[model samples]
Target: MPSIHDILTKAVALHNGGQPERAAALYRDVLAVEPAEPHSLHLLGLQMRRAGCEAEGIALMARSLLLAPTLAPALFNQARALQDSGRLDEAIAHFRRKLEVDPNCGVTSIVLGNEALARGRLDEAERILRRAAALEAGGAFASRLRRALERVTTARGIARDAADPSLPPGLVVRGAFRDSSGYAHKVRQFVRHLVDAGVRVRLVDLNHGDVDNLPDGQIDPLLHTLDRPVRAKAVLSFTTPLVVEAVPNLKTINYTVFEALDIPPLWAAHSRRHDHVVVATDSSRRAWLQAGHPADRVHICPEGVEPLEPGRVAPAAILDGTGRRLADYRVRILNVSDLNSRKNLEGLLRVWLRTTRAEDDAALLLKAGKGDGASGSIRDLLARLTAETGRTLGEAAPLFLVEGKLSDTDMMSLHAAATHYWSMSHGEGWDLPMAQAGAMGLTLLAPDHSAYHAYLNGRVAHMIPSHVTPALDGYRGRDWWTPDEAAAARLLRAVIDDPDGTRLSAREHLLEHFSWRSAAHRLIGLLGGLDAL
Candidate 1:
């Protein structure tokens, strides 16, 4: 057998070469001979972590540290593992211990600074990053540290501005404001309402791109103002609440949209980080309460809808993939959703094909987006459906898959062209498109549950009969509603029979209940209530 030194050397080499399993076996062999060998135990712990055994890795690392308390590498590795596991507070403690062991560890300082930056501790991040810069002069690490320090300085300045009393009482809205996403649309509409109501606001677009082709011009001025510090009365964050943990010394409202009954442990923790949690519907509020959040801290603030201008006509013809005009169809049914299992496109397609024949002169226009791997699945399903129905593209197949980044005007045009807006979503945080379509005076066909219940009524919507079912995908283990196929088919036929009356009623009911003015009033009241707390 080789000596411990030779075995340790080979294990280290293997570990560095990314052969963690081989390295772990060698380290275990070394430990079998000398059970308290600190190096063997530390290296094995890191290997175990790499192999996806986090708890075992942490245990081994702890034991190694017990044997050699000043093991700098072991301490650093443990801290990194803890941080990766979202045990940020524990990670900070471990990093502090590592610094104590090796006071001049520049890499440790940089890591600590980065962790601080992630946690939104700007002052601490700047301090540690400056120390890292001093320790690592004239190197890549030093250059990186300097850049990080500059960012920290800028962030600190922004935080200061956020807390400034000199500026008018305003709101700083942070979210994916530029994307063609539901969240982005909600933020855009809400910001528009605030501005229209004569309130001061600044937008922090987190979508990481230039704001292009957004529907409203109000977002234009805010885009150029992103680089400036935001001095606002409050920060309303539409992003995940986990971000609020980094933003200290401000009253933060966590604006979240939860589709399921049960909240995940991680999300619940993030929700508690904010001063208040604003949910889109009463069902969402109940979910937070069930997840152990304080009832007083969770408030219901439903989203608003902006209808398209009246008298706007759809294009005379929409070009299909082959550039052929699909204008022969008499009726258009529009379904806009991020193509995913939750949207239940599979079920929707099945029901549509089963209900309407090719001779019905109706087209199902699927305006789908936002799924990374969902396009392939959608194509496959469409192909299967086409074969089953014996329909060719654009003629026998009455389905058009429209996928791209659509402008607001383009979206409104699609809604205007459609005779009915349809969805069979398993769940919804708040189905923005459904509400928008309703506001646009388009007849709706959706389940009468979740966020739909907040606005959809018999007066406006043809509520499809649905049964409760287990949620799919990210909402696993929670209950959601699935629309009855036969009932949906009946509703689809009913809407086609009386399109104008159904559209008028839907538009009236949606405008009465889901207006931006109402949402903004509720929001302003909620912000005022936060002050009393």
Candidate 2:
């Protein structure tokens, strides 16, 4: 029942699976049967190019596209060849042609924009880059294009400021919130949304934190510059009338107003000094009101998550194809968080130790991105728990540790691979990874509090069923920690025993509630309110 298309699909799969030489043969066989198949032609052509047959691959791809002008991939491949071949004019035309066919294509627009910049067509490059950014929410290529545009715009701003001398004053929001540890990358979402919605927005990130323990691309490298203080003082002198505070760093001190901007009136004071202020939280509304800044002057917009496009390539190709399931070996429960004291990893550890059924088939997998700061303490606690639990569970039941910060794409892939996503955080500002897991259709088990609860309908995710008891200090905080060792045993028994039916339903709940497109629409509505501002 398989057609030539199916066979070609398999060939593409083989190519993706790292057997490109074998894939090349299958592709050739397909071409022998149907010489004009554009998809196979384009893909094989790309493979050929990558394998060092540039001229032959370029000619084949160009011929394939000429035979089928509507094939976007072919057009893209042809543009790549043209660019490398030093035919800029032809490359630009074909790149734009790809976008004309598929306006949502990000790669084409990026290349076209980059070429435009290379040719000194700044305005055209800017327009194309912005459009491309909207299409692909997050990617290294898109990030590079955006940073390039920022550099160009900043240069122009400096030139204009020099000519005019007196400029329209403004404020730039910077700084991190208490719960914004893992979700710091989402700040770009806020800045981009504001820019696309017609607000003049600028981003200045030095990644001013310690690079020693931080993950790559998570923080800006410029922040650690030895001349940061001198540069900061200079920037402060430059933006005299315009203020910058309430942001993460104390960079621009020479500017007017040194107040932090979390909510409304607090934000409004800066807006009163300038034209507008950006607010990260709704609680800032009270601050703005107290500062006597009108609602119109303060822009209230939360950061957004732009969903990754469904991979153009299939998922089966990406997998190892060993065909193993959790039941075959130990069941791995993954918890993603930094190894920080505040994250409450200890509570989960305590719960794991008391559970009886977990002693047999379960292995706790903690994925920590941050360096091993408090890891010795955590390992010691985990070892103690394993010692107590292993009496019944056996010696093979100790927990395993895998520590490294994964990129957004790799993290999503891992979430798709996980048995269940667990979040035992004390609190989260946006909880981007949890939302991403939901979007990836993974079963999530989380604490029922803070912004996590606000995003999920309470009935959806599994909450630990326990009433608040007094803390060790006898303080009045709610008891999220399980004191009754039996409670932990009961919770584990319920989750593991009903794995199939319960897990399927939990996945269904995620598909219904958390999605990238749905989040994007919500963001659009939020931006709509800024018209009054």
TM-scores of the models, in the order given = 0.73, 0.46
- Write down the lDDT of every candidate, Cα atoms only: 0.75, 0.52
Best by lDDT: 1
- Looking at candidate 2, the ten consecutive residues that score lowest on lDDT are 228-237
TM-score of 2: 0.46
Local lDDT at 235 for model 2 = 22
TM-score of 1: 0.73
- For each of the candidates, the C-alpha root-mean-square deviation to the true structure, in angstroms, is 6.1, 22.6
Model 2 per-residue lDDT tens digits across residues 1-533: 56888888889889889999989888888888899887778888898887768778988898788789989878877887776554556877888898899888887787777655434356777898888788776765656666757644643443344244244322232332111244344534443444454444334442323344334454443322211111110121112121232211212221112111222222233345433444333434334545566676544433334444444212211211244233333345667776554355766776666553433665555666544444576667677766765633233334545445454445565554456666655544446666665555555676554445445654556654433333332111212222233544465556665656556324444444444434434544543443211
In Å, residue 520's CA in model 1 sits off its true spot by 1.9
Ten contiguous residues with the weakest lDDT in model 1: 207-216
